[model samples]
Target chain A: MEGALMATEERSAKSDHADSSTGMLELRDIVKRFEKPGQGEILVLDEVDLDVEAGAFVSLLGPSGCGKTTLMNVISGLIEPDRGTMRRGGRDVSPDDLSLGYIFQEPRLLNWKTVRGNIEFALEARDVPEGEWDGRIDRYLDMVNLGDEHDNYPTRLSGGMKQRVSIARALAIEPEIMLMDEPFSSLDEITARDLREELLDIWKREEKTIVFVTHDINEAVFLSDYIYMMNTDGEMFARREVDIDRPRQYDDPDIAKREAELYREFHEHVVD
Target chain B: MDRLTRYLYTVASIIALLALWYVGGVTLPEVIPGLPETYAALVVVLTTPGPYGNMFYFHVWKTIEMLFASLFVSMIAGTVLGVALGRNETLESTLATWIYAWLAIPSLVIVFVSAIWIGFDASSGYFAIPLVITPFVGLNMWEGTRNLDTDLAEMAEFFGAGRIQTFKDVVVPQLAPFLFASFRSGLSIGWKITLLVEAFLLTRGVGFMFRRYFDQYDLPTMMSWLIIFVVFLIVVEYGVLAPLHERVMEWRPEAEGVRVTE
Candidate 1:
């Protein structure tokens, strides 16, 4: 438990020294609205204000249809909010300049590519130069502990392996900001539990800024440094800063109780 | 029954057909000649190597050459045009009416029209074959390219992939399985249409031989050459196209180790 806090502290200090510009991603007054020509306007998000600090793990928690996805998409530039200012590296940058890393709920792997081929594909697309490819591909696969299944195709992999490959592929590019949208929501419970631990370990190791979106309160409590809980009306109702030391066991009641309490707090906002 | 039993049933059916031919030759004595006559004629023509004997090989070879030439030309032209149409929505929608008009024209009509313009020569089938098959290949491949998984392309974009890299890594690989499937159907249709054109308009190939044999009422010789043509087509289907389809689509999970239509 103490070890994770120490690692986070060391990472913060190291980033403070390395270059303050590398880890900061900020969003300001983001609003996303949708409308049909014959129908009325639909406001998906309204004046959502949030700050993701350098190398901090944050989770956006809410019920279904609460616009956590819209917020993430706006940050990732998949959807353009009606009105907002997004800043990264202390300057207002477009989605292109933000260098966002995204992991969708499904693996979305190219069926034709082998596991290693899939990882190498991102490098090839980014033009990471042929010479550096061998090392970078191997290193990322090793991080996900998928080094052995590098030659297998996606069809041959289990659900868990496919998701791990996805994580490895996302991390390989070394993006300054990682955006995950309910990435583990579809997995078996046991696999999801294992992946959450693996994810935190990887997050600690990489020290990259992560903005994770999930509806699972326990998952948010267990994995996040700060929880930004949103109501169904697209408003950030509460921000819970969990000071629980990490590398804690999943079966611990203290963590479970906190997760339950957070869920109850968020549940009050849901109406009939 | 299993596949082996089904295969044996096909072979047994062929043997039964041959037996019926022999019996009908003896009993009816009025209809087509027996299997022995055609079989004997086949051996004679194969071994003699006369102008007539050698004509079969030449015509077969010429038909294959014309079929391949048209295939090569159409593949390159179709891929370029298909990609363009697929990527551009307005172009696809605008040209769709004309494309359908072209497709609706029959192969025989197209060859007859070409004969009027080109004056019934060896080159007639070559041009006619491409015209007949181009739209088919182009339309199928256009759909294939359009149906490509856009999510993978977005992944490519996230990795800073340029247009060419995204096409090569994401778009092209997905398109390959579809393209091969289209080609399997296209090539067979193209081969058949090329032979029909050769028979109807051209003067120097298997089609010509078939016409000559028909005029002479030499049923044995005509049937022998028809048998040879059928065998050649089977070889092309199994030996050429099936392998090509399997090789190109080897990456697809459903395509792996299992033959299409097996």
Candidate 2:
């Protein structure tokens, strides 16, 4: 696993240098507000800027209600920011133009659909070629280690299995950018740890840009190549690069050190 | 406690109620007919041909036809209109009061007014029955559609599902339980309203036969028809609606404690 991680890093480093453009996903001067009942408009996102390089795993780490999910929603085009411009592949693009996939905090699988049915639904919606559907569904399901659970309904699956199906569903679309909002927050620690490893493996193989939102410091440290620490007021307060070697263990000293440093940084930010 | 015990209890209760009714009728013949007399009267009605020729067959058929026709029309029209109202906030607000008013108005009044306008004919019953049932269905569907999972909806849209696709895949599945609830209730209410309309209009149905018996003072025959109609309703409720409900809700995890036994 360690050797494979090193090889992936070497390849990613070379590819990162090959692309000279700004980023695969670029947000400039993004602002958003919400209307409170008694109070007037409250600013949620204040002139936030972010750039995600192609095939990079980035985490937006913040406390609860820190607008991390809101930022994701804006990026996914589920909610439009009041003012902002988003660029993909160095060209201004709407959410509709980008082939985007989203894995919400909850496994929002259609209860009436089987695992295969859910994947097919996404494929159909994305207008994937009918001939390619079976191959894509089978391949992605196997990627998530759920090849045999194709006929099972969501209600029959455990929490971890359901989240895996969700991952498979998102990957089946072959999206350029995948927006995940705390996808594993609801799972038990053991299950979450396993999924995080599986996710890192998938990310290395798929080579897709992922913008993950979570409040867990260890999670952000474990998964991200770059962690953007967000303040409670929705501002990007700090950016840290995890220079440690990959195939990182949960109890690895380096990861624990980084996790402690992030915790301190978060507390200091709150104090500020 | 268990399935057999539950069935036994249900049977015991029914038998106890029948015993009480039989004793009451035998003691006070003026008010109620005994069980034996009612059964004899039912046999007579089943076998004998009235002025209309086989009153049981013809009238029962007409009632069933009207009941189902109204239910079918109301289900389609009500669902469409309800979905529209639920989706459009401005339209819902503008017409909410009118929907409430329609619900407030009695079915008897609607039947009478419809008969006055369209005349006391078979057509009037058909028209009035849909009008009576549509509002209930429409209102239930409106609430159901309004309360749909917006998160799922946003997810569908984010994944590039168009409006029609979202409605079919996300919206309709969530509304299934509500739709079935409305349908079952609407059917139950719809048949009763059909009978009332038929009675008032003196048209060709079980209601007309019931009215005919009332005028002739044939108490036993009238009671017999009532019993048969109630049995028919029970059959439709359990045999048709229950099975359909079970099928639609089969995806839901079974409740821990509930059990059904035949």
Candidate 3:
């Protein structure tokens, strides 16, 4: 298993050069701080650096309070880093220039809007051609297997279905990068597993860059081509290439072995 | 419970209350007028022409007009002001105290002030009712806007929604329940304030008629007017507002025997 991981890492390093030529998304020496009331300032992110190649599915895997979501926010232009530069396509990523789709831990759908309305809102916001709105919305909803629920309000839908709607809404925007912050973490095990498979299928079909943030090691292993493993201190301590093939199952022996090895790696950082 | 059972329970409660009122009227004739007398007075005023023509055609019409006008104006002004105050911290800090202060002052004070300024007329009722209702609506809306789910707004922003778009798509829909809440509460309070202003200052509407009947020692006429107005209020509340509220909030899942009070 170790040799397989090393071999995959070497292959990824070789491909990294080829992918970097396109300059998809780059984060260099990112730092963020927050004020803790009477405690003054606390550093949340410490000089983090990450580069995601175009159309790659990368996961930021760590425990709670590791600033994984914070990093996602910074990348999405929701929050400004205290220091460091974010570049896309070899240029500085301006808030206005970048097109991003974010899936929060919760579905965060507008309760008043039907699933179709939610997708329409995203389409209108992204300035998608008005003539194409219905087609795009129908396509994404069908992709997520929620084509029949377009007229149903979020409150009426089950949690898993609501999350699916969220996925459809995000995808309808046709974003350059999809930032997911533990979008499936709130679901039951079976639902989460099912959605994970659906998400991988979508990624394969759409070929969009995804920066998935999660604490679940198996999820990170199964979904990501490369996993940036961070410590509790909010630093990316290791990067591992998940050599497993596409459509990996949770119960697959190789995926489970990788998850166990990743857990060991995470625990070692905590001990250190 | 099913709709039929709910309606039955409501009707049963109303009948029981009317029975209690009838018993009280018989027990204390000086204080409470008998139902027969009140109903007879209602017939006379409603059918025959009075000093100001038919009481229902003129007085009740004027009062209803004032009630709706003030409600519309206050809803718009209060929602706009509340959204502003909720969004701006500086404005909230500067004006919140004043808003609460205005709310703390009784509607009677506004009625008196408006009467003195605008004179005893239909205009006085209009001015005073909105003054009394605006702060309540504004404060309720302020709370609603302040407690809006920011996560939804963030999602909107990430999808490339601008400020106005986000407010419309995200903020406004979330504020619908609160808007309805303020409207319901405002309607109830506005009617009382309009009547008070009319009784004390204005010489038109049902309130003025009530005052005139009371001054003339016409208990039957006054009790008749009270019954008619109360029934009207009940009808509007259940027929219009209750149905509207149910439709607006139908998307909410039924609570699991858990009561949430604000």
Query: Which structure among the candidates has the greatest DockQ?
Result: 3
Per-residue C-alpha lDDT of model 3 across residues A111-155, encoded as one tens digit per residue:
777789888988888888999989998899999898888777777
lDDT of 1 by residue, A128-225 (tens): 77888778778988998888877778877777878888988888878877899899999899988888888889888888778999998888888887
Model 3 alpha-carbon drift over 4 Å, by segment: A1-22, B18-23, B50-53, B254-262
lDDT of 2 by residue, B115-155 (tens): 89999888888899999899999998999989988788877
Q: After superposition, how far is residue A141 of candidate 1 from its true place, in Å?
A: 1.8
What is residue A52's positional error in candidate 1, in angstroms? 1.0
Better of 1 and 3 by lDDT: 3
Worst 10 residues of 2 chain B by lDDT: B253-262
- Report RMSD for candidate 3: 4.3
Chain B of candidate 1 versus the native chain B: what TM-score? 0.84
Give a tens-digit lDDT track for model 2, residues A102-168. 9999999998888898998899888899999999999999999888888877877888988898999
Model 2 lDDT, residue B182, Cα:
83
Q: List per-prediction Cα lDDT, in the order shown.
A: 0.78, 0.84, 0.84
Model no. 2, DockQ: 0.40
lDDT of 3 at B195: 81
- Clashing pairs for model 3 are none
User: In order, what DockQ does each candidate have?
Assistant: 0.32, 0.40, 0.43
**Candidate 1 positional error at A219, Å:** 1.6
